[model samples]
Target: MKLTKEIQDSIPFQYANDVRSGKITTGKYIKLAVDRFFQWIDSAEKDGYHIDHNSGMHVIEFFEFFLKHTKGPLANEPVILSPYQQFTFYNIFAWKDENGNRRINHVYEKVARKNGKTAGLAGLGLYCQSFDDEEGAEIYAAATKEMQAKVCWEQAHDFVFKGIGLRKIGFKNTQREIRFEHRERNGNVRKGNFRFLGGDSKTQDGLNPSLAIIDEYHAHKDDGVKEVLESAMGARQNPITYVITTAGFNTTSVCKAAEDVYKDILDGHKIDNHTFIMIHDLDEGDDWEDPANWVKANPNLNVSVSMKYLKREYTKAINQPSKIPNFKTKHLNMWVDAAETRIEDHIWMKSDKKIKLANFIKNGCAGALDMSSTTDLSSLGLVSNPDENGIIDILPLLFCPSDTIDKRSKEDKVPYRFWKDLKLKDYIDFEGTDFSEDNFWEKLPVLIATHGNQIDYATIEDYLQKLEAIFLPKWWEYDRWSATQLVQNMTEKEIEMHPFSQTISHFSEPTKQFEKHAYAAEFRHGGHPILRWMMSGVQAYEDPNENIRYVKNRSTKRIDGIIMTIMALAGTITPEEDNNESKYNHEEFTL
Candidate 1:
């Protein structure tokens, strides 16, 4: 392929080529992203996009020539971008559409700690405020707390005082903000401001931003800052929201949700043409102990992040197992929970087989309902009797309020609505059965959104009656605390409801069995994404008596599906002394 001068000179392009040619090592997702970049470049013209080499180069020049380092040994020195840093800036500024407008309006960047993420992005923020030529431009560095919000802003704030060129512009450096005074062509004075916006700030009204840099987004408990910044950018011609962060412990955070979206774009699952994503994380099964693999996450490995420093951290993590999760999260750029997870991702993924649920209809199943929170996700998990191969198939039906799906989607960063639209056929097999011939069980929705803000108990009762008539589940288990009313209503409908105690002793055996089935690949979950995500968040908590119960790493994380699955598994565990292994009756059931 013929390469333009811009492509040939681009550090990111070279990095991509090297990664593709095996000259450099990286995670599969990073490799996939770079590959996508090259593919897009090759077909960009036909796709109504163009690479404005000069525009990207101009931004790079501003960084190297104007910005100066404010701290460490490089204090007062001109900012020199590492190859990966250059790649980041080039991609963001280079991509353009048919109208010569910036193609990328948003960018999500994930890098390991000590990679100069704040400093580099701070320079970009300053550039957007001054050089972007937007009238009365507003630039914000936002975070959940005031201290965190000031981190990036301080870096940019210091650059103005240190950089001679920026200093000459007479920037008003206040205690909380920096401003550039200017007048329009009509002789009207306008002041462009750059400020740090904390979540507790008084008000964000009447604000119009040209660039909003969200730093350390993973630490955010909610989407308040992000939501405000995004909604305020509607009036700008080419506004950009730059989210930059390292890996964090909270799997249920808004940052992790944003990561999922960027990941989908990289994986070719979904498309958002205006968003640019570059993530650096350890690949699946990558040995974090290996120094050779460290560069995959820390792209500026030997530059901004020293090998000696990382080695010291790794050694500490090795000697003290408690520090391992922190090392992985901060140094290796992996989103690990502070507590160790019960099931490894590889082990859990092994049960993702396409088993036909319709074929097991005559085989009686057991169910468990988890309605722990009326305002959050509720699940009804069904488990079939072990087949001749000792494999148990699972079907989990999830529910949430219709009115809160979108709200929760934005707040929790999970796609509740998308999951609700998914059907059984999307994940499991439905062939060679009467149920497959029509839009019945085969097309049964996996997640249903009930009307209103609170879960409608009547809707759950109706569904239970339908399931009992069709599948004839032997019994249904319910949590004693939250399901008393539901159980009472179901009992009136002739459905056997058992109160399941939510205790360590009660859950231990079934939890152990669930793990056993998972490890042996005897549990078929059909690779449901929601279940997989919940499984990822699960951590085993052990009592002093050696009894164990399922718990989520974070309180905000929803593991109702996993809990219900464990409860349902209890009913399928037949005693060894009972020679009659067939738990289900041969009699057919009718709806």
Candidate 2:
């Protein structure tokens, strides 16, 4: 397609073609030239003057005005323009079909920061509001916040009020909408009004937008907001949806979604039905210090941005390496790691410890149980016996309730089912063989009587009482072994003496509180490797202060494992006590 005189004059067309043809080696230079040209167009248009070839605003204004009026009758499709619109229109809107059907296109762009994104988009807004073919066209420039929305609105407002020829076109900016009235051959008519709508589903709903621009689209907290805006576009035939933003924090975010769509277009994952342009710094490695990487990532250098500003930021970032990622990605318009490490290696290493599974099993075990109410996992902590030397062993068990079962029932896994699946029932040996599955209640008294002297069972109730009486105040003072042992004792079957209700009500608060304190304190202390591991594996949703009220956040496998170990220690304690008692009885008789 032959370039129009106006297009040839616009710097974007020249730089874009140069970049496409490999003549322009620097992406930043091309971006700057393009952005500068667009800014000039915006300035001229705002002043109510026509941008001719010599003026450099001609091509920019022409592309913007073309998009506004290109949709003949099907103007409501969410239309997005790409590669700053002018470069993309050659393939999409510049030519007429043999059948005379003008190709309608949707455009999307992913560009880095500080390269005239707002300015270029504002120019488009001006053209759409002033010269678009649709009369009374409802145009919207949206962002996550009202302030962001206003930024676009203000730009458009300035262009309409200040652009050279736009004033004569009767462009008027009201409090909320920009309106223009003009005379056609048929009759006097009014057209080109744009409204600013902040990014929210409820705010954009029910509006028939002829054109919509989603600025910084990735920063939106929820995808639903974007979806709502897209849904609103269905009312406009051949409507344009312009998604322009930089990379987001993670691949899961909105920016990544748009990036993926762009990639799919490039990779033939989808038909190239829409116009997509992705101009990003191609810096590949972790090395941000390399000037080569900087050049690759920032394509707006020396034009819109001064080299001095880049050097200053680079020096500042280098002085504090911690700020490199943010500076490189946000300011330099590069893709870098946005998710900072939540756990430092040194902190984790300082708290790490190793123990053999055999040794863990040999120790008298106590359990800490974290039950769940959702499909989230239940956790168990099995604390090892404290030897005469005051050492504690700990093991963790996790049980994740099945999502399907929980979802279908709207209930957590049945306790009996969990016990059966984990073989916990087998590990928990009842003293009597006469125990009945259905009538376990009838045999419970006998089992309790037989094991009464052998085991110490504490229900959740016993655990809480012990916490309030002995654990809370001394929690931090306890060594790793003592803390683990304490938690184990609380989980024992012998402590299970209950009107089960008594245990449930009393254990609820304090137990939760202890868990919370213990979890955070252990996290802070950076010791108690086993406790740290258990805590790391714990997915509890207890308040920061309470552990007993904690609900499991993930699968219960780890905590449940820990709880079983604790239970083992509690149940086995009786044997040791009984042996000691027998020895004393024999000595007394002999005496």
Candidate 3:
């Protein structure tokens, strides 16, 4: 029951202990993987499952014993699993069901670029084909293209050399297949086969796979190949779908979709006890420049992945903006587009300007409305103190249809699932009727009040009614397309509505001011995750006149919240535009 010094050195055990003891730096999903793993281990006895330590150790030790390191400084030496690698191996092979089937039926790992994934997966493929107890095991290395699929297959093929895992192995080099004569304890012999399957193959039938290793899942446009190959597993009593790759650029890729679902499982939004997930990457708050953060994603940092080479590349990336995206993607394991990005994450994370609605309600503030077309998002952006100090605080309320959360989340890759309220986090599902004139006035304020059951609806309405009693604005602004019933209602209240055209001439100056205020400590957003994501996704172009305009490109994120904030800031900067004298009257208001 106790871990000896030798056992304590195991990558899987060490990582499990480090995560349980809170000793290692990790991200949101990494924490989920570690916690869920231990939870499974603790509940195994009660679930009629058994922990086969020998079976798990057999995998890790097998890889270390016979797998040769192919193309590194340690080339030709046996492949020794790092702590993170050992953790993965331990999870996939250690637990067995009541009928002695492997508990982990599938594993999807979103790891950094160079942690020896190809070599490791090749070793596992060889083990499944030649060493596992199963008779006639079929293993495959699959990908979208034939050339891409052959990389892992070639690695597995190279392992057929003498002294490798499956010593005296038979390799049909022309056909790209490896066969082993596995002997049973009863002196009966069976043929275990491993081969490469290209995505160009017409049909994926006739494969009774025990293990399918999918490499570079991010490169695949969809999960077509994975689905077809996984479909071949029904006949096998114990089968596994293994996916391994780095972060991808295209948000619509199946890897991206699966990545989100895995995060959901990690965060306890859903449960999938059979699949093992681990995302090796730096946590959100960790400084990417720090060498220590490199180890967060690259578990093999100093070993197979050189610290000196990474430091050199990091220095270059810091100095050259063009190289930064690729460096972050490959080394730091962060998902970033190589295209132009406007709002910097480091700047947004440092902002500290979130104010309570009650405090802002006491003071008067101007509001801007952006009700995107009927099928999209509707948002209200509030900016306080337009005249004297110029936007002392900000209050944003975002609304989306209850039905389109998943569609929007997938399309933009933003965490809309977390922005359902006026809070700076995720979203709340809106269940009311369409955002009509009557509905907007009624539903918008309630979303803010009901978050975490902090305040009731009537109380928040009562507080806002007091604000309406003394509501005045230096100016109220809105995008032209948002001339809704709500816009008419606010105008009828005599708070002048300025229909600002979204043009370079009109918004160029305020947009620049907004950027300046953020970096110069003049403006602050409450460090909302969705806001940060929107800021990073903004695609802007600068004209020859030194003015800027936002242009939508092929990026995989939405900028709705940031757009609303900009509209709010537009009114805040034009303080002298108040034309109505009776705007400051204690206006009667009701929901």
Candidate 4:
């Protein structure tokens, strides 16, 4: 519904002169109260809240009655509630009942960062503690981290102690909860108290809560924490739960779940039993750099926020989009792509279907292995014999240390226990090995032993000879056109691979360079979904200058399949000829 200024002005302001004194009459007050309530209810409806109310004022009255006799400092504290704040609190806390018994409701809001979320939450927490149904009602301001949870608690304490005329409510600074309890039901007499607790599953479990406010919910790493907190509300008839957060980085986390739930409401996929409100600036195509977007994203513009700070931040975002994913996600309220280049999910899934371990043995394959000691997985790829057109079929094998395995043992070195656990000891022959070992002999033997069709001593030695004397030299000086043709042909087949360390480490930079020159270059790997897929899994190195030294940042995921595809391409080796005769002799070459 379109909200006009006249309609907005009709709502009651917390202070007499803030809007107009005439708007404070019981009828106008009730209407304004009802309108504020419905505004939130409507927002909740849009977010999938289910309610059977012809008027939202009824719900508001139910909460008002529930809180009417409650005695506390907040009951008499002068409250200058905005029309918007009034509506938000009523909708968030009030719900109708068939038995006329007051029941609490759930409220979830996806708002942009720095929109007075903390203050608003704190105000509601104090309100719930002071005036909600239960005497000495417990209120909580929770967040993903200790600092964030504490901030909400601190804000609530400040509002109680420092806000005009609120000091009469016994606000005591203590090691644990701030006490606001009153003994008599008379005006300004202590009756009930509210306490603040840090946001943690363990800390939240012991509290019997009347209301719970989760701040910065998008950052919550544990979904289980939410589950645990919700259980505490089961005993309260009208316990309220509020989840507040800004836009999240990607769809895999709690932020994404909130976004999805919001979408489900709009799409009519879910009915709203709870209130969900989302206030963001840009829709889809709105310029992310525009300063106007900031104003739209933050509704509290001149009230709770400084325009000068926003302007400074906006300028920084426009200039360097790549440097700040969190800033862009939170301040600009935009979804940042996970990486510069993401491999389409469809391509990766399809490639996975074509990978058959048996095919490598059946086709007389050759192999390539890339090993890493720091920050990467050891990867092996095997290629099948060339077809009439001279293209190789590739497959991949990836190995990494287990999570339980300690990186540092008593010696303060990365433990080799993971290598043994993954059975990598058999695949990797590190005996008498060092970084300076000759490239051809050092890696070739291990590759052959692990993946070769024939593993006898003589056969293995002979195969190494063929690869070193013939394959290595020809591969180094192979004609660019022939090599390109071979790679192009292999691209048609669905390749089997998982992410390996070496490919993930080097792929991003090369892919970036390739993308920059994609249209101008003749044989760009940009179109290769498999290559791009592997590149997307790469994590940035801690050292800015060292792009090649990357560790597997996400262990549950892999890029070994794409590494296998690359190695398959590398297997398109041909015999070298000297004076029109095939030469199968090794020659020493300087690195």
List, residue by residue over 401-433, the lDDT tens digit for candidate 3.
Answer: 656666777887765665654443222222232
What is the TM-score of candidate 2? 0.49
Which wins on TM-score, candidate 2 or candidate 3?
3
Better of 1 and 3 by TM-score: 1
The list of candidate 2 runs beyond 4 A from truth reads 1-13, 26-59, 62-104, 161-165, 235-237, 283-287, 332-339, 342-591
State the lDDT of candidate 4 residue by residue for 359-469, as single tens digits. 334345544444433233444445555433332333433433343234322222433353333321222323333422456434432112222221223332234334333
Off by over 4 Å in 4: 1-9, 12-84, 93-104, 161-164, 186-202, 340-591
Better of 1 and 2 by lDDT: 1
RMSD values for the candidates in order, in angstroms, are: 17.3, 17.6, 17.9, 18.3
Top candidate, metric TM-score: 1
TM-scores for every predicted model: 0.58, 0.49, 0.56, 0.49
The per-candidate count of clashes, in order, stands at 0, 84, 9, 23
Which residue pairs show backbone clashes in model 1? none
lDDT of 2 by residue, 1-591 (tens): 224676665554675656656665545433443443344345543433332332234335454443231223424222233333445433333322344322334566665565556666776666656555566677788777665677777877766654545667677889888887787788868676787776532455567777788777656766655566677776554466777776544446666766666556554566543353545545344355666555444455554455677778778666544345546555655554333422224443432343223333444343344443333444434444454444444433343433333332234333423332332122222233322252422322100111122222233234344323321211111112323444455436233211111122223333333333232322122133233333344332211111122222343323333333333333233233322121112322221
Candidate 3, residue 480: the lDDT equals 60
> For this target, which candidate reaches the highest lDDT against the unseen true structure?
1
